[model samples]
Target: MNFIAKQMDILHHKADWFTHIVKLSPRFLLALLIIPVLGGLIAVILPAFGWAPALNQYTIGLEGFRALWQTPGLSTMMLLSVATGLVSTLLAFVMTLLILAAFFNTAWLDYIQRILSPILVIPHAAAAIAIGFIIAPSGMLSRLISPWLSGWELSPAGIFPHDPWGISIILGLTLKELPFLLLMALGILAQPEFGKKLREQHKVALNLGYYPMTAFFKVILPNLYPLLRLPILAVLAYASASVEMPLILGPNTPPTLAVAIMHWFNDVDLTLRIKASAGALLQLILTGCILVLWLAGETAIKYSFRDKLTNGKRAYNSAFWQKTTYILTILVISFILLALIGLIMWSVAGFWRFPSVIPEQFVLSHFQSASVQMVNPLFNTLTIGIISTIFSILLTLLCLESEQLNSKPISNFTSLIIYLPLLVPSIAFLFGLVWLQQLANNSSAYISVVFSHVLFVLPYVFLSLAASYRRLDRRFSHVAASLGAKPFKVFLQIKLPQLFAPILIATALGLAISFGQYLPTLLVGGGRIATITTEAVTLANGASRRTSAVYAIIQMALPLIGFILAWLLPKLFYKSAHR
Candidate 1:
């Protein structure tokens, strides 16, 4: 009996020690994320001042800035970056609001979500390629109308996909980001109390001689915009600093600053790294300025419209706008679906030409060729994605568990840290990460690449999984503990089983994020680690449609598979509350 008592005492002590460690897990995660990002930013800033010891530049100077400014057409690149970023973000925001206001609980919302939930999982690179394939001068739409509706089909000269106006770039970014904005909006708007409050407010407006659309616009939107601001800012930052889409679609006379930064970074002369670093900082400054302007706009709008929000005259008969919004939503979804169809057709197409709606013959040569070439890239992509996602999910679970255990909500500082990766241009800080890796001589291809993937994957996993984890009824855990279940067993048997659906979905999100990483993979992996995304982006520079289609499809397939399983595995076991 004494021996058993001593053993019990030892076990209790061990459990206490473990509990204490778990309590600190959240702080550890914050440090793990904050340190690298802050360190990378500082590292890059040093290089921008010509202070890179790797290149034997011991003295700090502004020559890098000077070179960056002196580069030809720098103004055009800068303008393109700022314009596309802000405009697309604005478009996405307005579209999301209009769609939600016009059709929140209707069948339209259900249908749209059902279709878009999967397509949005396609990586930006693949989506951009699909959009490019559909809108190019000799693309599917052009083919459909050529030689019959229009004359002489030898690929007409047009300013799409490579236009000076950056319209193609905007379209691609908007198409891809619109769905994400919608998803984020759905999350906020789906809160029961928030939805009920909005419905009540909207109903009051509706009774006061306002259409539903107008009612939502004047009443619900002001209350809703704050929830969306961060995501909007993220979209703006991404659009402005986007490298892959602009590279594939923007003009060459003066590419977007991101592409130029990439060009300078990849230039043979190692000294150009200084100029690239400066350009990256400039890009960072540009994104920061955009954010400042966005906040300034918010304040201006709030003060200017605070009274009008309550007293604005109701616009009746908004049927036209509502109809337009609904039609526009369907059209956008149709275009995306058509683009996917275009990719599939092109991938298997044989002897396809202008004015041909369908290919005359089909062949598997491209797939066969892509299979052989992409074997290594696909392997690397899966490994990196799987490893990074596993780590992110594990870390996020622990962090959230710690949060719940401590009964503490995530602080503003923690929230900011979580969002830092998305806000800063990867160009600005990833180069800094590259420099750090070089300095520390820790440039192993596989490890660096996986670490890079985790940096990006963790945020998405946390945001998606946090809601589900927090929303689970506390009574289940309470009852389990009352029955003598320990915390670990409660987590394993109760929480994990209950959250399997969301856990799997979050894993899929992390997987998709990891799969789509481009710059992080490139800079950290040091060109030695090539994933399907890196290869796809490189191929998009000039590769043929069929070949590019093949690569794009493969990249899209991984995420599609994950998303499908995320959707299916839940229903396979039992009725899940996740979907």
Candidate 2:
């Protein structure tokens, strides 16, 4: 009887400890996300005013801002950044809405999702390189039509990718962002309760003599747009301050403000660091301004279209819009497919000249040579991705589990916190983070890089898993508890197994986001550690297209492998469990 009583006490202690830990998870998560960003911003703000003790400039003067203002082509850079960001975000958002309107509540949505999933996994740098290859002067598109249709023996001298107006940058950003927004929209629409309500509303509109497309626009979009606003703002922020795609596809003479800031930060002159800090702050302001402008535009449109919305029009040429949406969808998909094919072709071709639709001879030398060079970068990529993703998954699970145990939904402020990393420009805070690291005399670049990745990765993992975690039935846990299972034991043995698929999917997403990180790895790693993304971006700027293709392929393959495993492991686990 004493032994039995002692065992019961031990179990009670364990349960108490588990409950305490779960209750504290939310606070821990909020701190983990908020502290770094706040610290980085403070560091940058100090340096921008010339108060950097590391550089022995103790005077808090406006020297950095003075130099930044005097910089040549500053206006052009700012204009380009704002224009490209606004245009690309608008295009991607519109395209996403069109696709959603055309395919909502239909079987085509699933097919579209499956087709675009791979593109979603492809890293931004890799996508830029692939698109650059397809659109360059001596690219596959020019080659396919040369000497026959265009009647040009030599490669065309067109300013395709590096055009002075930053058109290619806009195109590349649109392509990369469209898939993300579309997938996010699809995920929201796939939810059972909200989706059913929207479907029923849409049906009611249709029965009231409204055209399908018009009905979707009037009935579904108003409800959907509010949910999608945050993601759109995040996309706008990223597009405004993007470094990777712009560096590869944008003009060099007067690059976008973000690219120019990166150059200043990397310049050999130490004083440029101050200017870079100033530029970073300016970037933050610029992003804020653009977001404000977008909001104002939204308000304007809402008032302007208030009459049309309630005018009781059903079929105002909905067919034409539907056809246009269909055509745009095909074009976007085809471009992505062709860009991928171009990357594969470039990775294998040997001495292939222009105007050849197919390579004259395929060689393994590029892959062979690149494999030897890729060893370190590939290892670093896997190490960082795996460690960061694991931390993200664990933290996400804890936060979600805490929510479940507490029976509380996430607050709006917490939702904003989850998106803070994405909504803020990376260049703005990352430089400040590096300063903090240096000030603290922290030299562990590997650990720093992994932690930086977690800041970005945790949000995505949490967003991906939160819905699935909350939707989980509670009866299983109740039954397990009734059978004398502890809370932790029920979570491990029952909840985890049931939530395996979503956890794996979230893990894959975390890995993909980590793999695609170029600026974070570059800034936090302090140029000491290299990843596949960094190597690919470096090679994309060089003369060797084959080498660039090789690195891009390897970079893309890592995320693809993660997604494949995520898809397969769940099926295998379920099959074995059944057997």
Candidate 3:
């Protein structure tokens, strides 16, 4: 008995030491998050400056940039990238704000929240395809009211999708992005300070004769925008450099700058890698320029609205804004719901021709075929999502436990480091990470891909888990300790059990983030591992609407299943935990 006690004590001490290291040392987290991002940027830059020996470009020169600059329609591509990024971001932000201003705190808000999760879980490529399915020439909308509405036959003559002005791309991005921005905004409003102060401000403004819409805009948005700035910028960066959306929805003739950069990288000849690196550098510069312009626009809006805000004038357009906001929200939500319906109808559809609302025949052949063919991608999708989510939960648990044990908030520096992956354009650094991995000869597809997913997933998981983890009263742990429970046992038996609900939510979010990833999986997996996203995007470009719909449904369904489990598990197993 004495010997067993001694051994147990030794193990406890070792565990304590390990926990202490994780808590006290910032270096590990920095290495995982910040160093890689910075290092990847440097790697790309060095090659961009013509210093890569792997490609035999040993001379320090601007030839890479020169070659990239000489690409056809370079100017048009840049303009498309900038326009789509800004327009989509602006549209999403405005729509989100309008919805909040019009319907927040009402039953409408509850309905939106209830449906928001599923909307957000729809992968970008799936969303793009859904939107394209309705708006394209041969799509459901045209088929439903075609000759009666426009007197056209044979599916028209133009690309509603892949339009030259990038309007369709912008619309596609806006539809997908609005839900995300709204979700984030909801999270922000849930903050104690934001909630309390916003109510107070709204009341104060209302008492001063301002209407509800104006009150929210004038009183709440100013205080709220700063908190949301990072998320907005992240979205902008993503929009500017997005490959999947552009490939599916953006103009194909010139393509967005990000797609153009990818073409250079994916060229058959390896020498084009030098120019690709230069194009990647150009992408970073382009993102930077867009961000700068966004900031300037922010300043301009603030200045322009200063008089209207300060004068306390009840704007006459408040009612008009409110009416339009509700209309827009209904349209946006209805469009998404209808799009999902379109996907479902198409999945089992058979031989549906132009000007027909319903298919001439319905069959299960699509699912029967997809079931066999999609097994690999579906399995890969599930495996990668679970793996990345597990890693995210573990890393976040470590960080949160460390914060609890140390009784200190994570430093602002660490927060910025975690957000680095979100804000920095993936095109700028992902290729370099791929290059580094190649140089190191690490070729495990699953490991490389999941690592990339984890990088993106960690921030979201941490954000979701941190509040619950911190809000957990320390009294329970103190009592457990007083009862002679070792730190390890307490953390295992007490803390984790107490956090079952939040942990589930975080896991679900991480899973969705990983499941939705397109570029990371493609780049990190070396194109050998096909997830549903890759398959769906690939099928979208071809004349396989039925087959693509099958993939899209699976892609959208996987994350939703995870989320349902996340929401249901806590209720079923830990009923009392909700209170």
Candidate 4:
């Protein structure tokens, strides 16, 4: 009993010490990271209950939710959102697995890895725009192919830009997500602990006469799935709550919930903001439901196949299926590359129209052209992106350190708050944020826009740093402390040196996320600040394929720059440090 009491007392002392150490560090960076997120959360939740002080509504009620429930075609719109999200995610997941299986040990693996760096850099918004530009009815593809193949004159009806099924939207999102998931899987596979053993097990199963895909499914995938859960969840959340893709490819009548929410938020009717807030809350719930369903399905699949795989049979003949998958992958990759090329062409084409196989003339005048309006949006985007990325990096470091030193890591509840932006439709919270901005009479659109970008970028920064931070050796810190170094100094001198690569990668990821932000930038900036994403969307809405293409190309370029910087900067630093 005395020993138990002593242990408890020591544990209590340790706990208090951990708390004191954390408190001593400046937490303002973390505070800055979370404030806008909380503001947005409060805005959404409060408006859902009809407690908008701006409108002199003191009493809370369910009128907003009721309105959302009563909205016509709401169920259909939600269903469309679900289908698009699930189909894209499922396809991306399957394709990623197939690619990983096929290329894990081959000579082609290095090339595959190298290809992902550039593709992963291209922002989804830009990718979506490129797809829209090429595949839309009257898009470059139809315009180019119709005259030659069909000998048919291209008309609005003949071109199927916004098909009712939303297939293009699904394809666009799937294409964008494929490279990201592949990159994430590469990162996971690079870890020595998991993939190496899994590969050996797979070979054994294959030798034992199990179907190769089944062996992969029964043996390899289960382990890969856990390492991949974070990226998969991110992909699902993104597809479910995505604004830009749906804007570009979803149908017109009742667009995806994301598009509807944006429309509601931007509506002149102040009442619509409440409805939009409620809808955004609903979107969050829907994403949660999908996540639950995915988890359940994953478990069910694992269990259903477990018994079948117990016998350890393997099929040696996988060549035919392997060849087919290889061809399919090539075709898909080719289509994506062609779409990217089409976007480049459209951007520079002078007055290119339908029925022409190529541009009549190319011009650099568009690239050279600059207007005050155009220039400011670009500057605003960079400014906000840089600010958000820097703050996200600093906050990520703090959260990672806190998790390291404390016995109890940060709770899922706190982590959920960081994920709030990704899990909910951006338009939903921005509706409430705009209301809050109006109430405060603080309409410096640039500040609000940057603040909103911080909210969206935080989760990604935190996530990218999380595994790297946890995997770090604590002995460095212990040694530094023994050498009389302060906690801050140890973090800066020892821990930071080791963590520099991951920190840079996380910052780059954050910068990419910010660069792609469309809804927050447009709404919080009050149409006053524009980024490449906003510019592309605006141009798309104008139906000027040429201008939209130019913006999309610019959009792709910005994130590409970030991706290259992320990949190269680390190698440079690590090489120098070793020397």
- The candidate scoring highest on TM-score is 2
Return whichever of 1 and 4 wins on lDDT: 1
Candidate 4, poorest ten consecutive residues by summed lDDT: 4-13
- Which residues of candidate 3, in runs, are more than 4 Å off? 1-15, 24-26, 575-579
**TM-score of model 2 vs. true structure:** 0.97
Tens-place lDDT per residue, model 2, 211-310, is 8788888888888888889999999999999999989999988999999998888888978999999999999999999999999999998888788788
lDDT of 1 by residue, 1-579 (tens): 444533443354355645566678778888878888888999999999999988889898999999998999999999999999988888888888888878865778877777888877899999989999899888887887888888846888878898998999999999889989999888887787887898788778878888778787788888888888888888888899998889888889999999999889888899999999999999999999999998999899889977766676776468888889978888898899889999999999999867788999999999999999999999999999999999999888888877666667778898878888898888888989888988787847788889878888888999999888988876676666656666777778898988999999998999999999898887788788889999999898878889999999999999989988999988977864444
CA RMSD of all predictions: 3.9, 3.2, 4.0, 4.7
Report the error of model 4 at residue 525, Å: 3.0
Arranged by lDDT, best first: 2, 1, 3, 4
Looking at model 1, residue 83 earns an lDDT score of 93
Error of 3 at 514 (Å): 1.0
Clashes of 3: 0
lDDT of 3 by residue, 426-507 (tens): 9889888877777787879888888888889988898889888988877777666656777777788998998998999999
Cα miss at 110, model 2 (Å)? 2.0
Instruction: List the candidates' TM-scores in order.
Output: 0.95, 0.97, 0.94, 0.87
Q: On lDDT, who's better, 2 or 3? A: 2
lDDT of 3: 0.84
Better of 1 and 3 by TM-score: 1
Q: How accurate locally is residue 226 in candidate 4, as Cα lDDT from 0 to 100?
A: 81
